[model samples]
Target: MIDRDALQGHLQQLLEADRFKDYGPNGLQVEGKREIHKVVTGVTASLALIDAAIAAGADAIVVHHGLFWRGQDGRVTGWMKQRLAQLIRHDINLFAYHLPLDAHATLGNNAQWGQQLGLVADARFGDQDLGFIGPVPDGLDLPRLSELVKRKLGRAPVVVPGDGRPLKRAAWCSGGAQGYFEGAIAAGVDVFLTGEISEPQAHYARETGVAFLACGHHASERYGVQAVGRHLEVNLGLQHAFLDIDNPA
Candidate 1:
């Protein structure tokens, strides 16, 4: 067992939360017991995740996404009230790392998702600091790579080709980040990929002539936090299990 405060401190340091520019706070959100043994890790700490943690008799739940969104007030009411009620009733600590998980060179969503897609991982890039691009080699056609994406993510992507050419390079940022397509274009990647696509984003992809793929917002992001949890269990000697809360979006 490990002290909750100490564990959060360790994770914050390991993630180097301050190193990357992000949108939300990255660290411990709700304090609970002094020590924790069983931890449930997931992509997002929604109601389903919290319930799974409680059912599994976990001491804490750690996630890539958590409560307290950027502009959201701290007031817990309505849905937030019910969410926090579950945690408080069960005395389960919640640790969240938003941008830190997204930007980490190894365990971040970008790297994990890239690894899943059979892309050779590299350092993160661009203003958003979401993730890095992959060189798909000179000869691989877009269709084959799309199949690979489907194989990895378990969902055929909504693909739109920008240019009438075979793919040479591609970039990925898991989750609702169609905003980065222009950067992918600027980086000269033949394709740009994200989780969910916006209507405007689809138009931009068609207009800019960049091959765009939306694998899934939730599906593309399940690996990194699980990686972190496994690392913690193996390295720190804690009992950690990942609880997947099915989110279609």
Candidate 2:
């Protein structure tokens, strides 16, 4: 068992959470039990995840996406009330990491996704260096790379074909990062992958001859929190569980 503040401090230091101006608070969004023993990690801290954690007898819940966000209604009511009440009743510590979880060199969402796809990252780009540029395997074309992504991520990505060239290099930023497509193009990658795609991205891909792949936002970001959970188990001697509430988006 570890003190809740100590756990939060360790994670803050580990992920360098304070360095990024994220959309929401990065650590300890809600305070509960003072001592955290078994930790439940998930991509989001929805009501379902909280119930599951409660069922699992968790003392703390860690997630990539927490309940609170910037520009959200400050009042705690409705679904938010339900989630907060449950956590409070159960005395479960709630911890969350946002951009930090995405940008961490080793235990980040982008890094884990790249590792899963066997892509070796050689450079970083985009806002806060969240984007990764890497080389694709020899002679790997857009179609083949799409298939690889589908197989690994368990969802068929929406592909916008480029100039039908064999992809030499690829760049990616997970979770609704289609905004970085142009930056990836500027970085001279043959293909750009992200969690979501907008209408303009298709036109950009067609014009620039840089392939675009829209992997599911949730699918792309599922690994980082799990990686952190395992890290806690190994390095901090804390019991951890990753309860995935399936999200198709």
Candidate 3:
């Protein structure tokens, strides 16, 4: 078992949480038991996940997305109250790492996603270097790449076809990062993949000849937290469980 503050400090240093300006605070967001033995990790800390952690006899809950965010109503009412009450009542610690989890070189959502899809990341781009760029296998076109993504992620991607060009290089940023499409295009990649797509990206793809693929947001980011959980289990001698609550978006 590890002290809650120690665990949080280790993670903060490991992920370099201070490097980026993120949407919300990184590291421990809620205080619970001081000694954390068994941890439950997930993509998001929804109420369902909190209940599952409680049922699993977890001492701590670590996630990519935590309950609190910037600009949210300060009042903890409704769902927020329900989640916080459960954690507090159970004495389960709550920890969240947002951009840091996404940007970690070896244990990040983008890195894990790229590795799972068999893509070798050679460069990083976009804000805080969250985007990755690399080459696909030879003879792989947009259609073939889309099929590969579906096979690996277990969800078919929404595709915006390019000018029928042979795909040479690809770039990606997981989880609602269609905003990085233009940046990927600027990086000279033939295709850009992200968790979600907006209407304008289709037009941009059509005009720029760079294909666009919208892999499911949840599906794309299912690996990093699992990776971290395994890291803790193997290296820190802590019991860890990654519970994935199904999310189609």
* Clash list (residue pairs), candidate 2: none
Per-residue lDDT for 117-170 in model 3, tens only? 778899999998999999888878778888999999999999999898888899
Count clashing pairs, candidate 1: 2
Which runs of model 2 end up more than 4 angstroms from their true locations? none
Leading candidate by lDDT: 2
TM-score for each prediction? 0.94, 0.98, 0.98
Clash count for candidate 2 is 0
lDDT of 2 at 19: 94
Candidates in order have lDDT scores of 0.83, 0.93, 0.92
Off by over 4 Å in 1: 137-139
152 in model 1: Cα distance from truth in Å? 1.7
Q: Provide the lDDT at 107 for model 2.
A: 95
RMSD of 2: 0.9
